[model samples]
Target: MDNEFYNAFASPISVTQNALLKNETGTTQKPPKLMDIDDYNGWSERFGNWVEAYHLDAWDHTEVQYFRPLGSDRKPIPIRELSDEEKKKYKNEKLMVSLLQ
Candidate 1:
């Protein structure tokens, strides 16, 4: 009983530790940052390649349009009620926005 309790508690701590440490596994070089209009062309090409290297399906995420599920009354349906595909798109949209920032 004690072993089970300790394992359950330790699992999350170990996972968090691994997540924090995983950054060291990658190259020290970071993806290109957009500085200004003069650098936009170079930055866009480099950043697009960088994003593609890291995320194979990233372009799909960029191209998809998210249409909110609407109820009969025309109000948006609750997010919790979204279909699995919609939920994935919703999550990807937030991720893309974060990356753009």
Candidate 2:
């Protein structure tokens, strides 16, 4: 894997380790800053490519289901049907960023 990609993937673990070290030293450490969805686009693309390369149709299906959550009644709704603002917010969430990375 690319070093940049590896570093990005390892960042969270590093932060967690730092936090633990600080705690052991009786120091308080602030929480890590979150990344928005735009920050995750590259990672998402990479993951999608990896999945395609592996010939995993399951990953493709999971990706589709991810953007479109099942309704309370278990009905599927297209993610694009969301309002512009909602879409923007979802795209920028940390969960998406982490998963993408």
Q: How well does candidate 2 match the true structure, expressed as C-alpha RMSD?
A: 15.5
Instruction: State how far residue 79 of model 1 sits from its true place (Å).
Output: 1.4
Task: For residues 1-101, write the lDDT of model 1, one tens digit per residue.
Answer: 99998887688888786655443232334455665679678777866776667653544577766667789999998889998888877776676666667
* Candidate 2 lDDT, 6-88, residue by residue in tens: 89757888989876655333222221222345645554565555545543443444555435456778886566777776565
lDDT of 2: 0.50
Candidate 2 lDDT score at position 36: 47
lDDT of 1: 0.67
Ten-residue stretch with the least lDDT total in model 2: 25-34
Model 1, C-alpha of 40: deviation from truth (Å): 0.5
Error of 1 at 9 (Å): 41
